[model samples]
Target: MKERKIALSQEDFAKINKAVQQAAAKGSKDSLILYRDLALVTSITNRTVITAIDGNNMAEHVFTNIDSAVIVK
Candidate 1:
């Protein structure tokens, strides 16, 4: 997948989303946002996100889900 979605507050998400939009629009900077979910038993990073950006190839993100459900296909 070229994006990740995690369980976060709407406001927090908005902030992150705004940054991405800005970067994408500005075409000056790029962003790679990583998100994760706590394990039911253990509280740890359960996911990973890897985003790649460039002049032409922008808005390409990746989501390596540790829980498999955070980023649905």
Candidate 2:
């Protein structure tokens, strides 16, 4: 499969980073929902976002393999 890149502004990236940090503090090792529309499946143990989804594309989609969620707004 082709690799898809998600672009974020510096501020948006910072938001995501901060959210990730907070989730880590809570010992969250699951997918996180950011900005209501975006879903970030992260590995708290690895401190990385494995995958992401935008709101427009989240319609008719089911999020599985996730244990947690965080709203950035």
Candidate 3:
């Protein structure tokens, strides 16, 4: 098996957190957060990321079980 790793700065994490908060405010239980080249599947109610997909893998990729989506600039 191969393992993939990602490094995020505090500021980047803060941004993602803010997005999650916004989703929660909108009554989203699950969300797809688009940040830069990463697509994160998050659980709004749980306040945690369920999965992440990079831009390279996003082509023709299908995301399931998400109730909302947020694009972060």
Model 1, global lDDT: 0.34
What's the true lDDT of residue 27 in model 1?
47
State the lDDT of candidate 2 residue by residue for 1-73, as single tens digits: 0144567788987887788888778878775656656777777768777777777667787777777778888
TM-score of 1: 0.32
**Candidate 2 local distance difference test against the native:** 0.73
Each candidate's number of clashing pairs is 1, 0, 0
Best by TM-score: 3
Query: Which candidate do you rate higher for lDDT, 2 or 3?
Result: 3
For 1-73, candidate 3 gives per-residue lDDT tens digits of 0234656789989999999999999999999999999899999998888888788788999999999999999
How are the candidates ranked when ordered by TM-score, highest leading?
Answer: 3, 2, 1
Model 1: residue 6 alpha-carbon error in angstroms: 7.7
Q: Which candidate ranks first by lDDT, i.e. highest?
A: 3
Q: Tell me each candidate's RMSD, in Å, in order.
A: 15.1, 2.5, 2.2
Alpha-carbon runs more than 4 Å astray in model 2: 1-5
